[model samples]
Target: MTTLYLLGSAAPPVLEIASVIEGAQKRGYDVCLGLTPSAARWLEPQLTDLEQLTGHPVRSEYKAPTGADVWPRADVALFAPATFNSLNSWALGLTSSFVVGFAAEAIGKGIPLVTMPCVNAAYAQHRALDRSIAELRGMGVSVLYGPDGFEPNQPGERRPEGYPWHLALDAVARRTA
Candidate 1:
């Protein structure tokens, strides 16, 4: 089975992550779930259920060097609903979060990577956002943004179902095929 690292940030779309995992599984992926720290907190109650669903532990923090690897090597990775902070941090090569760190290293390791941000129009106006997206693309990471991928809504508008998860999954399928 294709191993997929499905990482996420603390965006509203992350609340429905279980369905996203099921979507990946239905597409024949062996999924491993990872989240940003705040995302983990947001989904704390569902963590165990998510672990059971993926058959892998949900990791938000780095593992101890002494521990053995729990997840399989990823053939592809999808970092969806990546918040503004995480996206910018990733492009800047700051990997304080586990998800961003793994993605940063994945570039050097040649793992196929895709990302879709879930920022509002207000936050998307930041000058760094465009630069960050460009940086990720320069590293061969397929960034799904703007009109086709994830169009930012107004500040308070929530559209979890509108997140184009299929786009993320499909991009990985193409990359790893």
Candidate 2:
């Protein structure tokens, strides 16, 4: 079972991620979702659906389930709709939430980490954000999709409906194929 850790934040692009996760499962991949507090609010129903679909519990807090000893290992990690706050936090090694903590741990374990940042053009242009991206890349993490132009407040405006999802899944497929 190739474990996929789907990390997301409160950004609107979460709808895109919802579609991606569902699509990925349809293609026969085991997915585990980890959501930031803010992202949880936007995707509450989908989170439950994801759990049912993947047969693995969705996690939003570190203590949700622990002491299992043999935690599922991820083959791929994708952070979509990565908010600026979460990005900065992750880049600085701050794991305040389950998603962030899982990401930090996954990266530390040398798993393939991919992030698709979804922030407004203004925030994306910030020097700190740019530097953080560079630092993450330098650490061998792939910015799977980002610095792509996106306007704020558009709930489901994906660049090419399903293209980004395909790209993300392709990354994992290539490795496991």
Candidate 3:
């Protein structure tokens, strides 16, 4: 069974991520989730549902029940709807939160890291963000999607219609099969 780490972001995408988690469970993967603080607010109820669906805890902080122990090796680490702040923080090696810490540790261990960033056009077009994204790519992190051909400053405007949970799970399936 593939161990999936569901890293979270903020709202609008929270609903999408819940759908993704449900999809992932239907596909029969062992899913474990971690959410950023902002993402947490939008996903509390959904988190409990995810835990019930996956039969494991949905972690949001390093103090979570599964933290600081030797974790079961994951097949992939996916960050859907990755916020600009979380992306920048991860790109710069900051691990103040559980999601960030897990991503950092996974990267260091050479786990396949995939990110689908959700951000406004102005932030997405910033030079610093560009550099950070480039750096993450250089480190072999695969970015699944981002804003394109969308108006500036509109939150969650450029997200794809369906969540790419299957794509992420397929990647893991191929690797572990």
For model 2, give the 10-residue run with minimal summed lDDT: 145-154
lDDT of 3 by residue, 66-171 (tens): 6465346687877766777888889899888888888878888988887767667668677877787788888888765543211234554643544445565565
Ranking by TM-score: 1, 2, 3
TM-score of candidate 3 relative to the true fold:
0.81
Query: lDDT per prediction?
Result: 0.93, 0.72, 0.71
Cα displacement (Å) at residue 40, model 3: 1.5
Model 3 misplacement above 4 A: 64-71, 146-153, 156-177
What residue pairs clash in candidate 1, if any at all? Answer: none
User: Which regions in candidate 1 have their CA more than 4 angstroms from the true location?
Assistant: 159-161
How displaced is residue 121 in candidate 2, in Å?
0.4
lDDT of 1: 0.93
lDDT of 1 by residue, 1-177 (tens): 999999999998899899999998999999999999999999999999999999999999999999888999999999998999999999999999999999999999999999989999999889999999999999999999987698899999977577788887788788888
Please give the lDDT score at residue 150 for candidate 3: 18
Q: What CA RMSD would candidate 2 show?
A: 3.3
